[model samples]
Target: MSGQVRNTTKIVFIGAGSAAFGVSFFQDLFATDELAGSTLTLVDTDPAALDRMAGLARVLNAATDRNLVIEHTTDRRAALDGAGFVINSVAIDRNRLWQLDFEIPKKHGVRHTLGENGGPGGLFFTLRTLPLIFDFARDVAELCPDALFINFSNPESRIVLALAKHTDVKVLGLCHGIFLARWFVCQILGRAEAEVEVAGAGLNHFQWLTHVREAATGRDLYPELRTREKAHDPAFTPLTRRLFHSFGLWPTCSDDHMGEYLPYGWEGGEHGFDFAGDDKNREYLKTLIDDVASGAKPVPDDWLKPSWGERAVAVIGGVLHNRHRYIESGIVCNRGAIPNLPPDLAVEVPLLVDAGGVHPVSLGPLPDAIAKLLHVQASVQQLAVEAAVHASKEIALQALLIDPVITSTDAAVALLDELWEINRPFIRPCV
Candidate 1:
């Protein structure tokens, strides 16, 4: 389970001001013995938010048995010094800008249901955020060149692509989509989630389950999965069923998210997530900030139990402890992982993470049909990366026009105009 365990390791969180993610990540750090005694550096833009989360991290560290070193700063460079793993989940006005990421495309006559990771919205989201992300990556490249640069931001594939292409840092974009594939198989088979082994590959939100087998017997379960979907498909996953019916392989993630890539996504799909809960969660974090700053509410004792998913934490542990582990799916440059897709394009595929670092595992080739569907997205994402880094409106327009959803040239121009004027402040001349 171990290759090289560092006597002292540093894990820095880029967006520790995010309450839900910060809280859950704190829980994960406490739960992992592999990272015990390592220092945690928290970075964020908001000072008061930093003050609040710093208090919570201290409270959690005191309650835990591990000798966790906790520090907070708005200066990312100050935090990146000698970091082993740089975990990033920073968002620029998440709920508010996410609303813009969704609605702006719809205004341009794009029939998109979910704009988070597909359509023009995803492109714009990548454009706005990568500037900030690349800034962090540049510092990491200079300060902690060997650190595993991990991103938990949205439009995971595009972000990884931008960093991969623009920065010297090799990045890995981790998403929960890979786990959903296993859950989908288990649900179809009427088995416990732990009983199903699934292999999936595609874009981040648009991955497909290529293999499903029973864990104990190594029996193929795709036939039975098809049979169940034919008899009674779940309404909750209509888009997945639709793609599976056409392409003959179940896709990972939910209908709304999968709907983002398809042209007819708006017919019976959602445009974006109901961030009402997210909004409430942000407000709750605000309250917690006040409570922590005012010394009323302390860090919850139950976080010691750590009930959140272990995707990011596992990668953190794998590198820091040299515990080579197989991650179900992580986004990285193709490097021939999928022969059908471009070698330079970032794709979500399984990988073995260890002392050698996060290596992209070969997943053979996707069916021509699936490859064709993802290729368009790969192009749009690449163009978006170019547009963001170079500040090219022409490139951004080309990306939107190339996007399957925004086919009309006139519409693309009009849409970009509106989106540009609206997000002018944040986008800041980054076309």
Candidate 2:
């Protein structure tokens, strides 16, 4: 379990072309000494994009002197054979489709905060994403049955729930939202991030911080956190601040993400996602990758360092070498992890990862009022998955109607039809 130990496990990266994921992922791989001799297969539908990342990976491999066996392919099935780990972060036509996911719902009079993880946006995301996810699960089940499937897709709770409900793949969904929670606490408590410990359990975008303490002293910091929060600037994280007061448990993530699950989420803002900004960032990263890979620019020192915040590679190392470390957060099936929530629901909670695999840490029960709110989302997410799996128009409509963000049945019908038309080509009946 020492950092000096090396393993030759075959690790497959599906959707390796993603500029956002590829850079941090490769950095993490290069930084892990135990995985130095491992086989890394990069798979993507776009050959050119895959080649670019493969080039970047090779550059990092040589620079770090890790001796990793690097491979790339557009065909995922070819890369799946005998793989011990599969990391997936695929998005279908990301920005263009996401723009519609935001605009079309607003056009129907559905007021939402963020269109990616909850509200009408979340329903459409589940619809557009699940068909492909099911296909990936089927492939993993057949080709590499024992490989740990690490998912980094959005609509995290819904995706994890769908995969857990329908597939036999050993799956785990990882997100950086918990770090957002830790950051918020550190900013408020005037403590460094490493000095504060925070844990939460709920749906992905809507987790509540049930445990917040000073890491050094094991002292509860929530009492002081509440005191400082009341006098703090009202404009900063206003919606989350309000929710913490109302629910008596601080909501994790930020205003936009936390706002997704509430009807009054528009109080945060309705400006929607900045796709242009994202596009610009992606292009810049692509250029940087090409420069490093083609030797036009030197391999950046950051590329040789570990990922900024991602935990997937750390989980892979833990499972590979039996390092029983506590992972801050992971998306997993509830299964009584939270006593009040449905066992089938996917809840974000602290995890214990080691050779036995990822285990969800029980935080007992949340407050009754908070549980009521999450229960509604749990039902909505369940219906959303069912709608996607069957491609059932009726079920999809039911999901929209029951959602708190949708006020009008007529609008729900209109939004569903319009969004469905856009995503129809990608959605297929798993049953």
Please name the candidate that would achieve the greatest TM-score relative to the true structure.
2
Task: Give the residue spans of candidate 1 off by over 4 A.
Answer: 1-6, 285-302, 428-431
Candidate 2 scores a C-alpha RMSD against the true structure in Å of 1.6
lDDT of 2 by residue, 200-276 (tens): 99888788999899899999999999999878888888888888888899898888888898899999888888999
Q: Which candidate has the highest lDDT of all?
A: 2
Q: Total backbone clashes of model 1?
A: 2
Off by over 4 Å in 2: 1-5
TM-score of each: 0.93, 0.97
Give lDDT tens digits, candidate 1, residues 320-360. 56788998889998879989999889899988988788988
Candidate 2 is scored at a TM of 0.97
> What is each predicted model's overall lDDT from 0 to 1?
0.80, 0.90
